[model samples]
Target: MKKLFTPFMLGSYRLTHRVVMPPLTRMRAGTDGVASPLAATYYSQRATEGGLIIAEASQISQQGQGYPHTPGIYTQNQIAGWKIVTEAVKSQGAIFFLQLWHVGRISHSSFQKDGALPVAPSAIQPAGNAFTSTGQRVSFETPRALELNEIQQIVDDYRRAAENAKQAGFHGIEIHAANGYLLQQFLEDKTNHRNDRYGGSIENRARLLFEVLDAVLEVWPNDRVGVRLSPFNDVGDISDSDPLELYTHVIKVLSARGIGYLHLIEPQVRSGLVEDMNHEAPPSVATLFRPHFSGPLIVSGGFDADTTEQALAAGTADLVAFGRAFIANPDLPKRLELGAPLNVPDKSTIYGGAERGYTDYPRIDEIGVNTSE
Candidate 1:
């Protein structure tokens, strides 16, 4: 049996354990998409926690951004800023990967360039709104359909971003093809209603995603590159006529690319409702996707200690990523090892807040070094 705590050699990185901190979007960077000193402090504090650290989804271009303050990788200042984060994580002896992101239709005009409506594969608008810097919620604007020329530009943006990530002293990358983003929008039949080569059948629908991956890999080795996918997630009103066929083809194409890993955000919702009425034995994506994807798998979404151990024990996943747990407990691996009580995350400062909730989480030192004699 492969223990979750056992050491593993993934690509060129030697991880101390199998527990990976999945990419989590805190939206805490400053408005310029510059990495904050608080972010450096936050990751540095959690450095001793085992395995790899996949950094949050970073915008590849200004047009790729949907949120007010998420970090970007295109400009010089952004790369220099992210260097601080990579240096901090490396100092703690953990490998970090930059997650490249492009939020397609999940944006308001206020978040777009010159208040222009965001662009997507189709002219569809998502069912949600975005929070601006002023903390005001605005409905998502209808996205402009992408032209072939514009599509080429977007692909170039990802390539440039990948090269920038390498220059920023980061190890590897995970393309943001999950969570109803640009690549995901391109993959979904409903969101991508183009008649061009970029849409239609499964092969055409997946062209955009594969192209972006190829671009990123041009700057990064397959051993150092990973792609994140959420096949059946209905977020942003995304769906496909044949999810299994589309995903299997996508995975098969990716498998031969010699990519390092594939991280899948498991299906927790189906068509705006909790899956299978939120029943005892809900549908698991591992059953649907595990057979087709023939590479290292990292599964995320609502996994507990026993559940993660069971998945690894049964070979359901190569690694299990915990999102909220890593936020509240910087020493989450140590807590899980000792079965210690987890610090409940404070929802107040979860997004765009000061360092109170970001880097102020208590570690085992504060709890164990009690001098209450």
Candidate 2:
């Protein structure tokens, strides 16, 4: 049997397989920022016994929101909405995790309360468009640099959000520090131009991330917390002067803390775009960071069954995360094991839609395959 199909121990949990479903944002939530009822069905359809699933990125506070209809965990209604999702996923005996997110400068004022400008580590304007509350693409605004006291508030927000996830029945939490979001805005040099404790040197720039992790760790054990990072992929037009040095320090500290896992996005896959599997790549991100991170490492971005198995066999990645493939194949593990065909995902319905592209994907058995024969 392939290593991808074999059982593996992640922290204290025994996973039946190494195939993980990473967080994918589908803007199907209501204007109140509560998850749709269909979200429960969507997640339960993909859950497998002893498998791991990281649900979509959810805002930790109203200030953390950047896009329309994305779920939030701060409100009572939001917590109740996610409780249903967790219950459905738990019914399948799978380990469910919620990815905590704060979009930082990747926002327009329209999405903020009182139409306040988005906040980031600095008041820099990223070179991209922001999605408005009405789904219009508007130019990115120069974000307000978070005040020294305000930084502590954001940290508190993360802690409160972690508590909310626990209330929502999540087994764990994954901090969204990757893909040029708020946390990454603080990590990279281009986005963070502050002279305070949160900027300048590599250690200073990484202070906010460490602070957020420490805050979240206060709510749950370190072993139940995961941190996701994108060292090479430059989404949000953000980059660091020396990614290797920065991530090396980050991974080493995380290793020392003995977190549950370290999830890295492969360099080949750009954020918010369909992956080009045939693209040539440099040394794999997993291989580069494997030696530094002592805990279980999950590598996401454009991985199929063959590559996933190869990654596990090579010991470069303890687990592999599939985003798009899993979006189209609800029973992805069974399909991969049976060598069955997968459904093609409709890009048009990937975000802010109802049940069509979200939970309607057919299982292998439903496709008229008879594995029992």
Residue lDDT tens for model 1, 1-373? 3377877677877777777888877878888899887889888777764469899889998888877778899899999999998998888888889999998887667767788878999998777666554557877678899988889899999999999999999888999897788999999888999999998888999998888888887899898999998877777667777787888899878877768988888777332111222222226777567777677888887888888888888877888888888989998877776667889888776667778888888887787833332
Q: How many residue pairs clash in each candidate?
A: 0, 0
Residue pairs with clashing backbones, model 2: none
Clashes of 1: 0
Per-candidate local distance difference test:
0.81, 0.90
Candidate 2 total steric clashes: 0
Give the number of the best model, judged by TM-score.
2
Q: Which 10-residue span in candidate 2 carries the lowest summed lDDT?
A: 273-282
* TM-score for each model: 0.93, 0.97
Estimate candidate 2's alpha-carbon lDDT, on a 0 to 1 scale. 0.90
Error of 1 at 125 (Å): 1.6
For model 2, the stretches where C-alpha displacement exceeds 4 angstroms are 273-281
lDDT for predicted candidate 1 compared with the true structure: 0.81
Error of 2 at 368 (Å): 0.5
Candidate 2 residue lDDT tens string, 1-373? 8888899999889999988999999899999899999999999999999999999999999899988899999999999999999999999999999999999999889988899999999999988788999999888999999998889999999999999999999999999999889999999998999999999999999998899999999999988999999886678878887888989999999899999999999878656632323143356878988999889999998788788888888899999898888889999988888787788888898888899999998998787887763
